[model samples]
Each structure stands twice: as C-alpha cells, then as structure tokens.
Target: MLSSVAAPSALLPGASPVPVHEASAERDRQWWRSSVIYQIYPRSFRDLHGDGIGDLPGITAEIPALAELDIDAIWLSPFYKSPQKDAGYDVADYCSVDPIFGTLEDFDALVATAKKHGIRVIVDLVPNHCSDQHALFQAALAAPENSPARDMFIFRDGTGENGENPPNNWQSHFGGPAWTRITNPDGTPGQWYLHLFDSTQPDFNWDNPAVHQEFERILRFWLDRGVGGFRVDVAHALIKKSGLPDWGGRADGASIEGFPGHEAPMFGQAGIHDIYRSWRKILEDYDGDRVLCAEATIDPLDRLTDWVRSDEMHQAFNFAYLHHPWDAGDLRSTIEASLKAFDKVGAPTTWVLSNHDVVRHVSRFGLTGGHARSGDGLGPEDNQPDHVLGQARARAASLLMLGLPGGVYLYQGEELGLPDHTALDHGHRQDPTFHRTNGERLGRDGCRVPLPWTADAPSFGFSSTGKAWLPQPEEWRGLARNLQALEPASTLSLYRTALRLRRELSLGHGSLAWWPEYDAEGVVAFLNNGVLVVMNMGTSSVELPAGELLVSSAPEAGRDGFLAPDTAVWLRLA
Candidate 1:
C-alpha cells in the first residue's frame, strides 16, 4: 500500500474539495487517459546483487517508495535478454529476463509487488528490430538468399560492382551505413541487411506474417504475467515504405533528421496504424485497462496523434512539447496544440520533460543557449549549465506540467532534482552513439548514471559493493535521497506534496481553461478545475491572482502577493 502523506485539505486549512469527478469503474477502465507513469531505467534504478548493475529485485525492493509518489503506473525500460549493444534496447529474447537483471522469478516478484501497491507495470516492447544475436537473426545469416529465415528480416543484394556497395542509401542512426554485408556458408558476401540503429540491431521485415505472429505471441506472454501494458519502442518506425526508396539522393551516411518530410520512407508510415489496431485488440482482451503507449517521434502534432487514435494506442509521447524552448508562448502554444490534436482522436496527450535517451531537463534548461537536442551529450569541455537556475526552472516546469489536463510521464530522477553528469570523462562513456560517432557525439550516458540513495554511502547506496556502472557525480551527494528526505524544501518533498494534491483534486482528469486575464508578458496563468495555476517565466515578479496559496515551486518567491520569476504556484481561487 502507498505510504501515508498529508492530504491537501490538511495542507490548505480552508480549502474545499476541487470540483473534479470521482473515479468510478468506467474511469478505472480508462485510467491511462490521466495516469502518471514513471519511467525506470532498470540498469540505473538499483543494484541489489552488489554487481553495480541494477536488476528486477532492486526495483521490487523499492515498490514502497514508488507507491508513496502516487504514480498510477511504472514503465520499466527493456530488461529483456540482450547483448547490451544499445543498453538493452536491442533485445535477443523478449519473453525472458536478462541474466544480469535477474531471473524470471525476480520479474514475477516485481509485478506482484507493484500490483499490491496499486501500481501497474508497463514493459518496453521493441518490435522495430532485434539484436543480431537473436535466434532468428542468426538463422537468417546462415540461410540462403530468399530462404524463409532470411525473409524474416530485410535483406537485399548489393548494387555496385562485385556487390561491394549497399542496396539503399539509408544511414544508421548511430552514424554509419545502415546496411551490413553478411557472409554465406562459402565465406562469400551473400547479401546486405538493414539496421536503422546499431549494426547489431537488424531491422525486422514487418511485411512477413511470421514477424507479426511472433510479436503477438510475445505480447500475450507478458500480458499473462500481469503487466498492465507495453511502451512501444520506435512505434512509428515499424513499417517502412515499400521498394526501399532512396532518401531524396542525400549522402549515403547522412543523418536521417536531414530528410524532408514526416512521411519519410523510414518513419511515420500509415501501415503502422494497422499494426497497433491489432495490438489494441490483444490489450482489450485483458480484464484491466491495458494500454499501448507509443514512443513515436514523428513531426507535426497531428501526425503523432495518429498513433493514439481511439482504435489504436492509448497514448503517445508529445515529443514536440518536450523539445520546445522554455518560453511561455512556446509552451502555451504547444500545450494548446497537443490538447487539440489528441482530443481529435479521443486520446490523451502525454507530456514528458526528461527521459533516459535525452539530456536531463535540469541541464537542458540551464544551458547558455537554446535547449539541447535529443542524443546530445554534455561534458567538461562544453559550456557548463547554471545549476541553481536550472533546478528552479525544472521545478517550475514540473508544476506547470502536472497542472495540465492529461497523462504525465516522469523520468526516474527528475523528482530528486537530478542533473546530467555533464563532466563525465570520455573514457567512462558507454553509449553506442559515443563509440559509433568516434567521440563526436557524447551520447546519453550522462543522464543514465545510477541514482543516489545515501549521501555518505559509497556508490550513494546504489550497490552494496560501492561500484556503479556509470560514475555518479560528487555534486550529487547533497541531492541524495537520504538528505532530501529530511529537507522539507527539497525537490523530492515538493513532488510528494504536489502528487498528493493532484490526486486529491483529481487534477489529471480535470478540464483546463486559459486564464488570460492573469497572464502577463512572460507568465502563463490557467485554471484547472477552479485551481489557479500560475507560472512566471519573466525576469521579475508578477502579482498573484486572488487565491489561497496552496503550493509553490519556490515558496519563498511567493512573498508579498507576487510570484517571482522562474516560479510556479497552485492556488484555490478565493
């Protein structure tokens, strides 16, 4: 059961119940529409085996702590059997747990423990590709051209003299040609295979019925294990345009982002919807409000909304909103656009600030220039972030995001006010992007550093042996969970208070209305179920609305009936 926390009524002495609808059976079935799901990168979450690598048992042990946050669900990143080529994103076995993470029994314990605390488990499902070490991929390598095994993946004969060049111009996302030539039984260059990511992760030929059947079986296997749903990885890239067309005569190894349209040959294909519609049926068969959340990065809010249509996925990450600069106008416009777009498909918009694959929001907001792009790495050689300013903005952003009327996805360490290990040494990096780019791109290893639990313990209490896969920064000592647990003004305390009030007010399911009367030049003011939520982004303080102060991102900044810049507040209208 979730740990007891002070109720909003207790926090605000004269506050009345917010006029939001109560949860019922029907609402329960549609719980995901307004759910707060936390993404846990398993390898960095906790290490119970003293091996420096976190596992399932480590997560199970922290169930009580998670339950206290009042999150509706926990989304576990890929823990499937893999070669660790892409930090478990490259899966060799979807149905079993990786030996490093623990056994199947450990996973079962995690599911049961999470369920007992009213938290649902959402597994990461990688369907666009599989690890080269997968049984089917190995068989495909040995099988003759046009053989059934080879047909399971995209394979084609090279085009140039002596078949030395790749069949297409697609480039690997990690920084190289997307195709890798395979050797036949006689040691001849048999054919080339496609890998949108690392060469070790070969793209699956979704055109094959066998591929569809295999994933469907994999889905059922986990659904039977009591998982609430799956977070579909690269949800939009599963189906590529037929004929393997060239990307508009671009350079052979050019970046995919340089391509022209959202309907590029490699992504946002219409056929991908058909695939989700089938998975939706599988989820519908289950008793609970099972869901499919998409990790699609398609451009234009409308195109991304297509993944979350009523008959398809339940939610899709709003990447456009995530990448937007921290300006009131930009944020407001994005929020309005996202709400309108997802509303058209009868699906809820999902908001996110930081995730395992991107630079943490704290550092991004603190950058001297514009926000950092996805897959960007920060280090000692780069301009350092303003730690104090970054944390304040991050806290304000969280309050603003939680006040919106939709589902929210919180990254693992955001609540603890964690920042990326921007000064990590190059030699200590492990992301494939770092190696593939030949040290050009620093990659996402900085944000994936192990969590800090104890301020004084070695490895910050992440592992008993004091060993961590990715080194934790020394500055994290003050931000450790133990020290923050004792500080009432800490980010963790604010998160707990906000989460409790959000639940009490039913804010996630509430309606949103722009309170333009209170909006200033750089301030965003809105009313969520009669609660006035105000965020000041300008350089000076703004007069607060007539309301009883309930919670503020920077409480000290709310003095004199004025909200300071880089601060946010939730209030009950007087």
Candidate 2:
C-alpha cells in the first residue's frame, strides 16, 4: 500500500547510539546449553522514566546487574503491544514494543546492550492468544463471510430463542466460558470466538495454516530485531477440540479453582506438533543453539515431553519438585521421574523450587514444617520460628537444583534469602486466579512483588514512583541485594560461591543419580557425582556418613550426617 520511505539515519528520531557487534559463531553455538536465565517482570522492575511502570530503558540500564549475577541470560516477560487486560500476555503485536514499555528503538538498544554484556535476551512469546483489540483480530471480526481472516479465530453460529451457547462448556482460565458471542451492528448477533484466558484475549485456532504462517512471520520479525530465543507461554494449549464438548461443570461450583479451566480437553491436542515444528525451523536458522523453553506443567509432568523431544523444545520446566513435600520418598520419585523424562527426550533437564507463580519453598515447605499455611481460617498459634527457615531451605533447594544434571534456574530473591508471606489484605489482591468463595484459594501473588536492591533506600530501591505493582513482602528490608553482598555467611555470598563452583566443574556436563534418602522417615538424599546430599525432614539434627561439609543448611554439621530442623547437608563422599 505504501512505498518505502527512508529515514536520515538507522537510529530513531532522538536516541543515543549503543555499540552493536554481531555475536561470534562460538558465542551463539552453545548459548542456552548451560545458561541460567533470570526472569524479568517488566511491571515490577525499575521505572526508568517514572511513568509508574518499568520500561525497556530501565531494563537496558540494568544489564550490568545481570552480568554481575553470573547468570546465563535474562528472560523478559511480555513487552509486546497489548491492551494490558491480562498484563502483556495477551499480545496485540508480536513485533512491536508496547508504548507503555518504550519504543521499538528502545527494544533494539536493549538487545544490543545485552549482547555486549555476554547475555542473550530470551523473550516470553505469547502466540497462543492475542488481544481482541489486535489489528488482525479486528480485521477478522470485520471480514466478509468465509474470509481467510475469519478462519483465524474459532467462529461459531448464533442460537435463536436461546442466547448463543458457547462452542462448548469449556471454561476460560481466568473465569467463564472459553467462547464469547459478538454483537452485530444492527441489534442482531454475530458469531463467537474462543478465548482460553480473559475474554479480551482470544485463543488462535491452530488448525488454520494462516495462523501458523502469521506466527512464523512474527518469529522472524523479533529474531531480525535481535532476540536470542523464546520462552513459549501456555504452549500446550495451542490446539483445541474440534467437537467442542461441554465441560463437566465445576466441582465446587467455582470456575477458577477447578481443573476444567486450565487443562481443558482441548489442551495439548495432537495437531499442535506441526505448529512447534514450524517454529523450530525458524528458531534453528536464527538461533545459534537458541532454545525454546516450554513452561510445561508440573502436575501432569509427562504431558509436554513431546514438546521437548528436540523436534519441539530445548527444555521444559519440571514443576513436580517445586510442589513436593520434604519427604525422602517423594523426592526420590520426583527425581526418578525427571531422570527418566530427561533420558527419553535426549535433552537436558531444568530444576527449580520457586518461581513467580508458586509460594516460596522456604516459607511453604521448610518453614511451615512441610505444610503451606492455611490463609483463610487462622485464629491459632503463630508458632513462628526465631530465625528465617529460608536460609536452610534456600541451601537445600540450591543443592538440589544446582547438583542436578541440567541447568539450575534460581529465582531472583531466592539467592537473597527472601522470606515468603501473604501480607496482602483481601482487597489488595491482584493475582489473576479466581477462586471458589469457600475454603479454596487462587495462586499466590505476594511472592513475586519486587526485588529490593538497597537496604537504606525507600521501598528497598524498588521504586521512586507510586506504590509498587505488588506489595513488597515483609522479608524485603534486611535481604536487600546490596546489603547481603558484603556478608560472608549471607545467602548472597553462598549463592555466588556455589555458582562459581558449579561453573568450574561444568556441572552442566555431568548426569545425576538420586540416591535413596538416608533416614527412617523418607528424607531426601542424593549422590551428585560423588557428593552425598542428605536433607533432614525431622525437627532434630541428622548425621552425614561422608566427608567435610561443602555446604550445610543447618549450622551444626556432625560426622554422623546430622542435619538441623528443616535443613539439608552437602558433603564429599570418601
């Protein structure tokens, strides 16, 4: 429709120049193989221009911080154009940066700056759905009958007398029906489209080859813009049931807390494999070992292994261990399952005990004495411990994550000894999960609030603007990064030392075997290479049948492999 108009310079109208150097073949070759990715929720990071929201420049300015963390890369959450209905996950445009975050130029500068720091940028790609307001969706909505664009969405006919029944009884993850009826200009009604999430976010029909082409074009668009890789979101839900059957209504009569929402029979459909294969092709060409990490679920751990079969994804997160009890038997089976899954895919494994979504491990398992605290009915003993259990659980989880065969992914505050607690009043909750009005609860939000860089600064240096997007947890003050950096026995110090050791041994190079838990009550014990890993689930100290302590979650390390209350021990085997 228009001719190419050239700008005076490649730079934007007004911007400072950042050095750009093409990454060497070697640098990109094994880029994601052993890298540790730090996820950045743009809304919770620094607000550069003080618009009360974090932007590209703010992240660009913090590249030095990431470089110093001894991490593999930075995985940024959605920054694409969107209406912010479901945050940026409901992408409006794959190629453009949301104006709220910054301009296209800012994104380019951020990418260049990151590459210069020996870090690759892995973006959160949300292609399964798009904002209802997106241009493509709008075009499809306004199309003449039987148009190609119309096929992009799941359109259904109107029901007379009765209000239009949704294509099925499938529920949206955020709340109601997976389908929404559209009204025509005249008082008449038009067809409906399927949305797996918030209604404003409509699910794309993977059956449409055009949809595949559209996403492929989007992939190249960002790769050309210099993004190193992608962390595919809701990846397994790309395809849906053609029959569109009714969901056996909610169990508790609540839409959100029930299974019918996230794991609709439509999820992980067989047809979605072609979608991944096509994406893999574009990724192979542009990425020098660039990876596709599917946020595969932990509950039904086996469902997405096909995606990680090298043909689909480089790795998928095993969410099983993150929710495990501190028992030896549970840990053994969890590790066994992962070991088997890893061997099956012929791809490496990734481990973590905490992330933005789950309750922090130290607070949940280690501190609650193995039970996550009940948030609703609490009038009893506060029996809180004197010292933070996070210190011990942090070390324990780290020993498990880092000592595993694959790469270790530690969330931001985990290394800082941050404690987890639900300090939010009922009205202040912002998590997207909708729960049953009864005893049920939605996902945790306070765990992912913000990272504090300094102790003396206000809001722990998280902001200079209005209140933070999520309330900073009570554990924020003393655990600031700048403070812990100086303490020898601090969590930050331990993390740095462990990471250096991991890099030295090429921890990424070896495979792992989980030894039996060495206790009467199934306490987890694993043999990492030759090191003995024993975690004590009991309140008393447990002895280790091994060498000197390389690291101990408990203060009292005994020759008998004695671990303190809710603690873990790592020792070299003779």
Candidate 3:
C-alpha cells in the first residue's frame, strides 16, 4: 500500500534538491526528452470487434486509461496493411491500415482520441524491409533480370554449380539462409533476393535513389496524418557493406559476446547515418516536436549512441539497461554509463524492461540466474519462476526506473503485474521463430498473450466473442486490472501513485546523483528532485535516510526506519 507520510517542508538541512529548469516554449515542445511512452502490441492490446485480434478502435477506447497513467505518448506496433506473414512487420502498404486491425478512418479516430487526451501517437516504421506482396516486389518478380524494377531490391546471381546455392553466407535473423532463390518470368531458376528476417519480408536496396524517395513519401504521409513520431524498426540494418561479404558467425546471426565494433557485414554500416540525416531534415520541417526513436540492436552500447546524435534520432532504446541483471552494482553501472554516453550526444536515454520481442521482466526476474536472453521464452518444460519473488523484484525495479533522469517505455499490462504465459501450449504457438527453429527456441508468444481486463468476463473482456488471437493463462484471472484496481497495494495502484508523483514533482525533468553514503554491496541509493530513492537488493534490511516517506514498492519498506530487502522507497527530504 502507498505509505502515508507528512508533507515535505519547503527546505531541509543538508539536502540539495535536483533543480527543475524553468519550462520554456521550446522545452514544452521537446516533451519526448523526458516522457513516458507506452508500447501497445496491437495484436494483443484489446479485441474490440470480437475478431479475436486487437484493433485501432480498441486502442482509442483505452485513451482514458492511458491518460490516467500520466504517460506522454503511445507507440503502436505495426498495423499497416500486410499479409500477416511476420505479424504486420512485413508491411505491404505503408500508407494503408490492415483489414485485420481496421480501416484508415479507424486510425484517424485513434489519433483524434489520443490528441483529445493530450497523448501523442508514435507509429512503428519498418524501413529496412517490406512484405514480398508489396507492389514493387511483385513488379520486380515479373520484370526481366537486370530490369529497373529488380534494382529496387537486392537481387544477385548465385555463385555455384548450376547457380543453386545462396549468393553469400549471410543468415536470416529469424533462421535459415538469408537469400532465397526465385524463378524467372521464363521457366528457369533465377537470381536470389536477400531477406534479413523471414522470407516473406524482403530487404530493400537502400543504394537506390527510388527507395530513398519512397520512404520519404511514406514518412510524410504519416506525419501529415498528425503522428507525433516514428519508432524506426531495425534502424541499424538499413545499409549493408558494398560487397555482400561472407560472415564467419553462427547461422542464427547472433552477435559475438565481446565484439568491439560492427564486424558483421550486414549491420551498423556508416551509410545508415546518411539516411537518418535526410530523415531528420524531413521531421524538422514538421510542426510539432516530432521524434524518431531507433530500435537499433548494436552491441557495445557506446556504439549504439551513434543513432541518437542530435541531427539523427531523438532517442535510442537502451538495450544494455534492459538486459542487465538484478544486481545493484550491475544496474548502477549501466545507468551511469547510459547517462554519460547519451549526455555526450545531447539525447535522452530511453529505458525499457519488456517488449513484444522479449520475455516479460516479471518472469525474467523470477529466474534464479541473471537476466534471460531475448526470445528465450519460459515454459513448463523449463524451470518455472517464483511468482512471489518475481513480483516483489519487478515492483522495486519499477520505482528505480521511474526515478531515473530520462525517458521510460512501459509495455502494456506491465502495470497490472502480468507475467508471461510461460506454460502456453506448444501447439498454439504462432511466432515464425518457433517454426523456423522447429521448436528449438520458444520464441516470444509467451509475452504476447492477450491482456486480462475483467476477472470473470469472457476472454477476460478482451473480445466480445470469447476468443483471443493468443490464449490467455487461467492464472491471469487473479491479475486482472478490474480486480487490482480496488486493491491499494496492487501493482496497478503502485504505478498510478508513482506516475502521479513523478509528474507533480517534475521528476522526469530533474537530474540524478548517486548517494554514495548509502551505497553498499547489493544496495543502490540516489537523489532526484529532493527525493532520496533507495533500493535494498540484499538479504537484510538497511537503515533509511531521515526523510518523509513519499511512496514505496513494498508495504513494509520504511518499517522501524528500515528498508526491507527487495524493496524500493522514495523519501522526500524537503
């Protein structure tokens, strides 16, 4: 439960409050710098039409709920017209809405509704690839070899006996070979095309001027429709080395453990920055503080900062922070390094715990070991997580993340303490990764299950037809939002209180300073906006600093002036 404490005095002895700079019109326009953005997996957020799939109308209906959480924006995963080959990431038409989600009018309505609630919309933009069914790709298939149409994508002749093998040793991110052989319009085996992900999603030839012009037009179309910004998908892989060079890595395309730079021929090419510079010009030409957030997965986080340069991207997702273990020292080092790196480029660091491509943080923290690798879904065949321990740690982590001095991204249903459906039936899995790997890896279906809204309602009130695109676990009934809303100590309630106080105190815009006096093994303490935020990751309780208790992740956080293990508390020192 939220602790009841005395109001903070205007001033206190030996306390230095983090200064909140005066907000000018320019500062107000740059809201993304210190904003909290909510990511909505459109396929699972809500099924308003009872088709067992979430849609634009469902998101519009939930604007009030998002407003209550005090988030600044909503980042919708791909809803573009597609064949659903890659679950909407393989966009067929960048400007049209998919029938499975809704029509263009429905999307317009969502934008209008979000604007009315003072929330901006950020759409997912997949520029690296497109669905094979796209008109240009179809034209490329029908055109003769060496035709201008074929030049829009990477199509090269194979180099082997009878030209039967892949052009190079490059591998797909999903699984299997990256190149797929295609049949010529005549009855003969022809050149192969490159696809970094699934075969249905073919990579575009960024070297072509037409490809650049097409993406610019797509960007303006969405910006004209009043979107606040775009979350660039696979931002680092847009360009490849001039020669399709062979790689000496695993067939699965996993990065090496300690590689210092972009050794892979397919990713982090210097030419990618030129594309973004051109895009930045287009965004600056717009009216609002339109942003561009990169989803680049480059390693050695210092290299990742390149995407967030002032003239490139507004923010880049800090994967190092997301994948860090639950140890106090590890988290502290990651936070400090991320702050320092992004500070050099004058861009706010973006923090995230869970997303559509990874296991939920609650389940990840519940494991006995350190952080779980992305796409390593938990299941009945594997060791199960301790629900009680996972929930406690997740709550504590939330407080720590919220108190940091940068932007934050909240995955949908995380506020309700939802854990991944780890025990989902294998037969029901739909992720391409699972099929491509032949069930060797569990993929991300566990974290993409439909959210539970009502405890007893059919399909947890997600769909009127009592069906969901992905099945929800029966255990989720206990974590339903409707039931948790009435409980003061619930995770949902904790998030509400934390976000409210964060905005009231302008905590997001404030600075962070490590409080070294309370820093010990398995303990992390920091000061922000006159609040001493402390987390005890150790087994024993620690003495709390003298201050009024503002809020806590656990009910017994400040009991007897001691902060309990696995608990986080925010104390107002002034």
Q: Give the top-scoring candidate (TM-score).
A: 3
What's the true lDDT of residue 64 in model 3? Answer: 96
Q: Give me candidate 2's TM-score against the actual structure.
A: 0.85
User: Would you estimate the TM-scores of all the predictions?
Assistant: 0.94, 0.85, 0.95
* Candidate scoring better on TM-score of 1 and 3: 3
Decoy 3 TM-score against native: 0.95
Per-residue alpha-carbon lDDT of model 3 for 1-574, expressed as tens digits? 3344544333336654332222223443478888999999998998888899999999899899889999999999999999998889999999999998999999999999999999999999999999999999999999988888999999999998989998898878777889999987677999999999999999999999999999999999999999999999999888889888888775433476653337877888999999999999999999888999999987777789999898999999998888888889988888888887887777788889989888888998888754344446876777788888989999999988888777999999999989999889999998888888788778889999999999999999888888898899999999988999999889999999999888887777767777765556488888887777888888898776567788899876774577788889998763
Per-residue lDDT of model 1, residues 264-290, tens digit only: 688877888899999999999998889
Measured by lDDT, the strongest candidate is 3
Off by over 4 Å in 2: 1-33, 158-160, 249-264, 298-300, 366-387, 434-444, 516-521, 554-561
Residue-pair clash count for candidate 1: 0
Backbone N/Cα/C clashes per model: 0, 10, 0
Local error of candidate 2 at residue 354 (angstroms): 2.2
